[model samples]
Target: MQTKGSLVGDLVKGGIAGVAGTWVMGQVTGYMWEHEDPAARQRYEEVTGGKYVPDRTAEKIGQILGLNLSEEQHSMLAQASHWGLGAGVSAAYALLRRRYATADAAQGLLFGLLFWAIVDEGMTPLFGLAEMPQVYPWQAHARGFVGHLVFGVVAETVLDVFDQAS
Candidate 1:
């Protein structure tokens, strides 16, 4: 069992590392999204019976708040959501690490997959922000999986650095 101080250290260190990892993830996914296979969108529509609009979550959030935002605003909101989700996941991971003594990479990978399943496949659809994951093309799914894997690896690396420093 970790003492209270060590637990706090984990929270701080993990949070910092997570945010860093998320930034890296964004950079990676941003490039992939820009260069994504154009045909993937058609496949997604065929599978999901819907259009694949990026950052629909931001639009939904705006609708919920009775606010209308321009394209630029939506883009900003999407960025915010990306960062917020990353930070939130990292913080949760920090706390979870307290109970489990697994290797960082393994734990991070599991966390990434769980986050994808819960957010991409489950919550997004449940909240009407996105179509179910089944509707997405294999290319889209692969891109997301790879992006999250990067996040996990980066997060674990940073966390290890912090652990060593402390």
Candidate 2:
């Protein structure tokens, strides 16, 4: 049973962990993308309309708000949205961890899978932020899965460190 202060502390730690996880996930996915076969990558780009999902989402949001953002502004907004989602979701994961010790089982692998399925496989397409999951090349799906797995592991490890230091 966490006190209010402890809950706040947990959330802070989780946000930091999430930022770290997001950075690492980006690196891993970037590497995968760079090494992906040209034809497959081109196919993915074609099906997904050639822009990164976050960028597309940002553009759509800007349009909705009637803000004519420059390209740089759009890029910044896209990055902010990406990191914000990572931190926000990870903070929720931390709360879940507080209630259920089992939530940390497999070093957050299940949490990662749930995140991938709910956000990547389901919500993004449902919300029109991304193309349907089936339209992507298998490699894209593989990269997303691996990246989330890494995110879960990294976030859990950081939280463990925080626990040890406290």
TM-score of each: 0.78, 0.91
**Judged by TM-score, which candidate is best?**
2
**C-alpha positional error of residue 98 in candidate 2 after TM-score superposition, expressed in Å:** 0.9
User: The CA-based lDDT of model 2 is what?
Assistant: 0.84
Per-residue CA lDDT of model 1 for 1-166, tens digit only, reads 2323476677777778778988888789878867888788667657655433347778778989998999899888987886777776777777776676664677678777877777776887887877767767778777778778888778777776665565
Put down candidate 2 lDDT per residue, 57-94, tens digits, no spaces.
Answer: 89888999999999899999999889988898888887
RMSD of each: 3.4, 2.0
Candidate 2 runs further than 4 Å off: 1-5, 103-107
